[model samples]
Target: MSDSNRTDFTNPSTFILLGIPGLEEDHLWISLPFCIMYATAVLGNFTILFIVKMEESLQEPMYYFLCMLSVTDLVLCTSILPKMLSIFWFNSREIDFLACFTQMYFVHSFSKIESGILVAMAFDRYVAICHPLRHSTILTNPLVAKIGLAVVLRGVILTPPTILLARQWPYCQTNIIPHTYCEHMAVVKLACADTHISNYYGLFSLCFVTGPDVFFIAVSYTQILRVIFSLPTKDAQLKAFGTCGSHFCAILAFYIPGLFSLLTYRFGQNVALYFHVLLANVYLLVAPTLNPIIYGLRTRQIRNRVLHLFTHKET
Candidate 1:
């Protein structure tokens, strides 16, 4: 028998995820905290959706963007939580090749979609604040729908090429993935075939996705700031920026760590495995958890609508 084929028979065709290597011994300690974070993330984003939908007062471009953001957060959390919880709660590490690719695809797809949506939101805010006289005309319902369609198309198209490139590579080597979820780069690295194409796509993906999105967001905020500063009334300036504070914070939380991780990994920085895993979890959790809190706290109308719903339900 060939020595290479001598892998453990029971775990063939799939790999067990080691899951944040050094902390495996203390897995129990983290389960409760992760569970709390997951629940809060889900419930918080769901509340945002509920508040947006039930409140007619929020039927505007900004609220529409907020609702889309909430939905993206829900999908993003779902993509990571089940796999992570399974590893933590049951110590189950078996994920089939197909399943792993599927997870990677959705994770990548939704993340890209979220980035696009944030860009769209920035545009909405820019128009609303910087060009108030023409905001309603430019950001009509049809225009928003078209932007949403473009976002979906961008994500759907960009994701498949990465998945196909990863799958085409031969994986005659060991399949042990180091983390809980199926990270594309990590999975591609396991392949026995040449991964130069995957690496190229990886770099291109970062530049193409992150570069333009960040540029648009920065420009939008700059214009927003310009308009706010031009206002003579302090109350007007405060109110204008107030509308964007939550989104800006959410964007910072989502983008900075992600870029840091990407740059560090690409440059061969020896980041701790746990740091990567923890940051992934935080990036997924923090945006969702904060989206609801930021919007709900900043926007009085949403707060009142949620309270009214609860009060009506209780009575």
Candidate 2:
């Protein structure tokens, strides 16, 4: 092959992640907060899982869904933060191409699964409130198992194409990804070949997964609100809203930063890269860190059980 042609098809064996541009000197300092967030997320989710498992009364549909959510959060944070901390604290930013793509797949897959779980939880609240008599009949253990299976299958089916398409390209351009971790678009941007298909498909996949889930969740909440308002007494309304408050907070925590980051990436061409990267990291880290905290404070059963776990002493 001619030198020019050889250059056109060249692909690097590894890529470097630029932890955070212009803040390289503060990598260690930046890692502190990330480390704390990861630890909190891990501990919080595990505690939720433990409490749900040990407390027989907590084995209802809502807590079952919470278990799914906790597992997804655990997988999501574990998929990214460990490598990210390595990059920040040690300047160990070199990632093999295969490893980078593997990380991207897990990050996106777990994110989709988490979104689906939120939708399921919203539906659980909907059934419990709108059709109280039938909620038990409707959200049976078998149904919950099916929902979990479907969520995993959706993530498994939708995410691999993006990675496969990316692998087909020749990454002859700079392999320095300007982000804390391997994200789908970030890695694709490093390819020299035409990326329109991959880029458009990524957007399509986001719409395909999150768009429908968010729409259904909104619909569920809308019906829930209508029911709450129609109740005869103010106390009843307060009680209904209380039941959903934690899930509402969780939805906000999960989607707000995520949507903001997506919008910034698509439209904020002149925005600083660091701002974009920071928001992206927040999208992944903040929700998991806050989810258990939200539930612990707002969920009476979980809060009581968690307290009992800590305070109980053996005779």
RMSD of each: 2.5, 2.7
lDDT of 2 by residue, 205-242 (tens): 76887889889999999999999999999999998787
Model 2: number of backbone collisions = 0
lDDT of 1 at 271: 81
TM-score of each predicted structure versus truth? 0.92, 0.94
Winning candidate number (TM-score): 2
Q: Residue by residue across 65-181, what tens digits does model 1's lDDT show? A: 878888888898888788888888889988887888888898889889989999998898888788889998999989988999899899999999999898777776577888778
lDDT of 1: 0.82
- The collision pairs in model 2 are none
lDDT of each: 0.82, 0.86
Candidate 2 TM-score, true structure as reference:
0.94
> What does candidate 1 score on TM?
0.92
For every model shown, the clashing-pair count is 0, 0
